[model samples]
Target: MDTSRLLRTTTTVIAAAGLLLTGCTTGGSGKLQTAASSAQPSPDPTALRPYYEQKLTWRECGVPGFQCSTMKAPLDYANPGSGQDVDIAVSRRVATGPGKKLGSLVVNPGGPGGSGIGYLQAYAGIGYPAPVRARYDMVSFDPRGVQRSSPVECLTGPEMDKYTQVDQTPDDAAERAELVAAFKEFAAGCRARSERVLPHVSTVDAARDMDLLRGVLGDEKLNYVGASYGTFLGATYADLFPGRVGRLVLDGAMDPARPSLDLNRDQTAGFDTAFTSFAKDCAKQPDCPLGNGSPEEVGERLKDFFRKLDAQPVASGDPARPLGEALATTGVIAALYDESAWPQLREALRSAMNGDGAGLLALADSYYERGADGKYANLMFANAAVNCLDQPPAFSGPDAVDSALPSFEKASPVFGAGLAWAALNCAYWPVKATGTAKELVAKGAPPIVVVGTTRDPATPYRWAQALAGQLDSGTLLTYDGDGHTAYGRGSDCIDSAINRYLLEGKPPQDGTKC
Candidate 1:
């Protein structure tokens, strides 16, 4: 039960290339400047000139037709002269040109942890519409504290396996204590292994890094596409450098206006909505595993299965690792990210119920970015790092989670308890939060497109609405469909609208429904 802000994009990446994977004001000279140049009213741009003026020497990476490079950004923006820098990993596929070239279209598949470079190489660079790709370079970067970018390391593969198995829904005081201990151990591991970058990995730091990247890339204005948590990051950039915004699209948006608890509860409800949609579709299938009365009945059946696993774990082909309640719940939530995964979920459920938990375990493994080599990627570590720094913990302790249970349960009977408990992980973070929940109204920015899926499981549609309304010039593009992000998930209307926006700088009409 990681933070709900975790993007479904990683699952998309896993399904595609098999790789596992957030603001402020305006300022000076409308030219590409240092990262911290215009972050404030009148900053000492000369101090950071080396970083902004540094050239990126892109070379062919392993990925065909793509180039990789590294950009340098200050480790701490508050004190640029500290001499510590984080090498941000970047990737790009230069425009295939049959049209006039637009500036770089930087893209992000939001995990706060998702590898933007992986997303670019795997999908965005190749799968994006040809016209848009022909006009603009498809670029992405693994933000600071993310994969290939001084990533935060917490636990070893085996330790993570044990951590994931920790009971999220504690039924007694002992279980609750165990949960807390697990969280403390996890936090301690982060502090011990990656303490230096932990406090500086806030969204603000990343946004400033983006500005530096923009300067290095020679892009006066950043044209971009960001999904899930990426939306929050892009919005933050717009708020900070409203005048530097080019054509921007934020799909599957998150509302920065909401507090952590509200976001967790909202995302829980969103998952319930996705599960109901999945269950309804399953009911129509002849071999629906949960049976066919109604969504609630199906949910109850699933809950019963989880309870059974809690009592006695099921075999998952690995003698050392068994399918427990936590992993099984993660597997189910993983499948709910995309409707195309529903059939796989059904089969996983059917097999799990019959005592073979291999399929569900595989799904859970993919969600965790655990490779066949028994190693885990830094996705989860960076996720907690950025999420915990971005806002205060949703729950101060077990008692706080208990107090919020009723509201969470009312929102999602199936996932409420686990998600509520999941919110408690940040409470034990070593560093206090540096960011506060606030509405981002990029007041002077140009029209930015915000895409929303009606039944997005991870980022609810209302969040998109809220974000669009918050931005002074945001235009809401609604996809009356399912899944997480709308733009590249097989919706021509959605894709075309975004493509048009990216290529021609013409956003769709406000309130347009696809």
Candidate 2:
């Protein structure tokens, strides 16, 4: 786990508690139950009827090809008849086809907080394969507490700027105290500002909202393509409504079986793996900033650079802001997301090493989505709120983190300590966790395709394997490549496989290697 991965929430819906189970035992049958089976009413389905039967009013959105709408879901599903309602923002581009339309294909990007509406308009809606786009309406929604939804707002732009610069790899008592204070202030801000919405934005709650969206759209089943954390959310929906699944693709899948601590640790290791790959590639390039050396040597050099920044910050060409260790590490982590960003990262590093930190600072700011006017988006705030409520904190405080430092360091000597400290952000959360880690067998569902990139830095490949194994109807598709995800990233094998599943309802065979 890097600092971003710690604070950022990926979209997934595994119960936070009692997350472990031996194997998939859903419905006692491996195959999907009848579609009619999903219609079986609950003992108290009356409370949900209003939500399930409500009509949607879609209108022209700002984007030329997209339509937008608002729908309401119970703030608390357990008490839908009594609690307040939260608004959901949805966007869609109807299929433009020369063939019969299959249905709506809902797409989600990783941040549990990533705006699905934005993803729909900017990427999946127009950028998806032409055949698939022509046959399936591309759809997306802002999950609760995400942008355009009932978003969770916390620190202001200035406040967030200060928060991001706080020394994560504290070297002394004073620095540690400052880091602790920053975390406390951030946690307190979220509590003060978003109390009502904080407790209800759990992944489980979002999954339930998806169910209502399904009904509102008049779809008998859901067709979805979710990446990174989105995989978790899609799987959770399947777990909650197994009979309503159709053509589900979970790319960069997460293991619902692991606890938060293990997830963080494994993610720490995953980043190390990705960085090593980056380093290996860099060594082959003449302009490598860390020098053309062995991976271990390069790791040491980068660590040394971070250590130097810890003692004395460098000018980033911004009078009020100087490049610090935390910001530099964020810049590094941002590049790990995509190999295409490698050249930019190299330039950023070269600039940083030459006493000019502007490039690196810019990269870090981009990762945090800070604007030129000092305004920050609600992405990080919502990410922390949802992640904290989804699982128990990895550590309670600095003391607990100190005790576990060795394990983390062993996981990734370069990024270990900073990630461990970042994990503490959830410890002081205002709301108690509403869910826990739990197996999502999603039994009695149609075959779900689980895709994994071998060198993905965020969700590890083993997690995809575990998730596939846990889901009774899961089929594993492996992409032996680098980067955070496989599909739609210059991989014909992956795109063809996933596209076929969505357009033709034909999932590729398990263990399909690309």
Candidate 3:
């Protein structure tokens, strides 16, 4: 849960590469200027538009149940009158059932950069609850620098291998220097590879893109559901186009009013909280590896074990592969995303401590999406690019991170400053941020539901409260449990409440804790 926040002054906010954790860029007035481009930027398909506007066709593409279409909007919206066009890839699954159909519903699964098109095709278009699915034409697309539309790529497979293996929690000067190199190389790769598209991928730009998509789809109002970073995207759309909103739902929401360092620090604390919960449960189980002890004791033992591994690396049963900091940290990050995986995490740790690295490596592989053949997806690369583009990393240099260690360690004695410094990956982003933090008031928009899971590690629950508070028409629905999101993680009460809202536009009672 990234908290996904930025600090604001009056109505303006300092923009960086997305959410400033604690230092999301405060006290700056208009450092990053908003684009003054026209609001009607749609002539992008052709350099010479007015002359050829009459020639372009908008026929629907055949995709079984979906209605696919192509749209040309400005690659840069500020100059909508410009002839340079950016084609948008769009798809919609129209509702078909005995009951009357609702207009449309857009789904976003937050990475500030995840592929909405892929999410739609894989999950929302079909995996959404049947009743809700039958009433709305589900829609999705790849945002500017995302997949399918026009992706922002950075590293090759071999280069990426070195990048993911960088040690975050450096023990010696050599290790620390290695970490620095990794960060610099990653930033350099983006600047070198994605320079053309990096500067234009800000959240504001994406939100405006949404507004244009809303128009081309023939909808006067937009209905949507966003989670994690998606919450920030939805909130931004509401801020920029308050009047065009309809039935918006922001779950696993991010706070839109914090800086980068604080955001990451809070998440550090959150993971600590989750670890504490996991520890308590583990100690009560018979298979507990750290032995039967108090939760705090179990945590202390785990921390000591990690320290031991840091000093002397463990053999992970592979000749060229070793279980190092990156893999270990990722294993923990993955566990934090899903509560259902906690017991598995405990077992993984137990096995790892006994010279068996397979279990821990498996968890790490899932987080990194590593394959048996050693092939890796573009998830981390895209994540770093989108995140770095959204906001500057929380810290700028290794010295700064070193100085901030005490506080980060206090935040999580186990994770410590490594997680804090990991937040600094975007501090030196090649492109500048074009968007800033702002409370989306959606003053006259229909009631939007903001859902929160009590112990969600990736998107902290408190953020949902913050987002709900900012939106004038937002109501809170609490899922008193753990995990990144509550939707399909299996709580009848949570699912039913959200389903009712999407299917019937019936918001659950405010402050209703499930």
Candidate 4:
């Protein structure tokens, strides 16, 4: 994840009892049902004890070519009939020309903060192979505290701009004080704006919310594909609802067994791996601007450039938008996540070295989701709130942060320090984390496919390996590419396997690497 556009991934472990809240539904995670029951009236809330709660009614809303509606759930499932309610937003793409559609297939793009509905509309809706989309009604939901289904808001645009620009990796007491003050201000803003919702948006709560979506969608079991942070969300679902599992896919996975500190450090190293790839590729190109040298030399040069920019921002041709260290580092981080953008990165760097930052700025803008009118989306705020609520920050204090700097710098000297600082956003979060680092053992659960890309800078390939090792029935699929995720990144072998599984219930053999 990067600054300005997103912070830490919102997905985290289950919280303590106080911060953790159940979804307003009728079933508990321990056991839902082996399979779908006969089509009948929804379960009675009063009939179920502390576990299951309210019955859901599917209705219609307007979205053209798709069905849209809200599922009424308890604001807190632990107490249903208490006159409190929360709305869950859902959208479904009905199965195309039939084969007696198998069931609903839910997809998440993994921001914990990613817009599930928006991802469906953009890539998964139509870009997914035809055979898969044929037998399954592609569905996506905005989890609690997400975009459509009631969001969490904090700082204003101007305030946010200042927060984003704050020096995270400070060198002196003054700089450290400045950093702490910025964190406090950010925390206070979130506390003031989203006091009640802050404690209730952990990943476990969101995972429970998914089970409700599955039940409401009328699916016998969960059929899902979650990427990046979505992997954490999917695993959490399995840990809680293993019995209700169906065909689930977790691509570009994260290691649930690792703590926030390790997670952030690993991600820092992941970026280093990505930049090494870019450096090697750049050195081979005739148009290389950052000098055609070894990867180490290339990295050092980038660090020098960043230092130069930090001291004196480049012209960038836009007086209103200076190309400072923050923006420059953000631009670099974006390229690390996906190799498809490597060529663009090289070009941007070429232009930047010539004192033109327009190209790099555009790349950074996309990752940040910045609009032209000097306005921004609510992504960053929600990202922090959800993540900070899930688990404690990787950096809790100055000493801990200082200790990790060397390792982070070792990963991608150009990017490590800034990312380490970015981790500080949640250090002063309004809500306390309810979850911790633990393995997700989906014992006796249905087959779950785990995909990894060797050069994925966001979620490392090893994460998929570890996740597959942890899950009782996880099938490993390797993309052998440079990108944040494997699916839809152009691989015939990968697409065909997923299509067969969705359309014919035939998953690729376990440990199949592309």
Estimated TM-score per prediction? 0.95, 0.92, 0.85, 0.88
Give the per-residue lDDT of model 3 (tens digit) for 263-345.
Answer: 77777777777777777888888898877797678878887777776766577776556676567666766676766677888
- TM-score of candidate 4 versus the correct structure, residues matched by position: 0.88
Better of 3 and 4 by lDDT: 4
Candidate 4 residue lDDT tens string, 28-57: 332243221111123334522233333433
Q: Can you write out model 2's per-residue Cα lDDT over 1-514, one digit (the tens) per residue?
A: 1263432222121100011111111111111222211212232456777777777766777677778888787887767778598888888889999799887888888676777876777677888899998998888888999877888999998888889889998888998898888988998999899989998898878888887788777788888988888898899889888989988999998887788888888889998998999999998998999999999999999999999998898999887779989999988987887888888889899989999999888877766767789886677888888788888888888999899889999989999999888888888888888667888888889899999889988899999999999999999999999888888889999999988888888999999999
Scored by lDDT, model 2 comes in at: 0.81
Angstrom error of the Cα, residue 184, model 1: value is 0.5
> What is the C-alpha lDDT profile of model 1 across 107-194, one tens digit per residue?
8888888888877887889988889899998898898998788889999999998999999999999999999999999999999999
Give the number of the best model, judged by TM-score.
1
Assess each prediction's global lDDT (C-alpha) against the native: 0.85, 0.81, 0.67, 0.72
What alpha-carbon RMSD in Å does predicted model 2 have with respect to the real structure? Answer: 7.2
After superposing candidate 2, which stretches have Cα over 4 Å from the reference? 1-43
Ranking by lDDT: 1, 2, 4, 3
Candidate 1 global CA lDDT score: 0.85
Alpha-carbon lDDT of model 4: 0.72
Provide the RMSD of all predictions against the true structure, rounded to 1 decimal. 3.8, 7.2, 8.5, 6.4
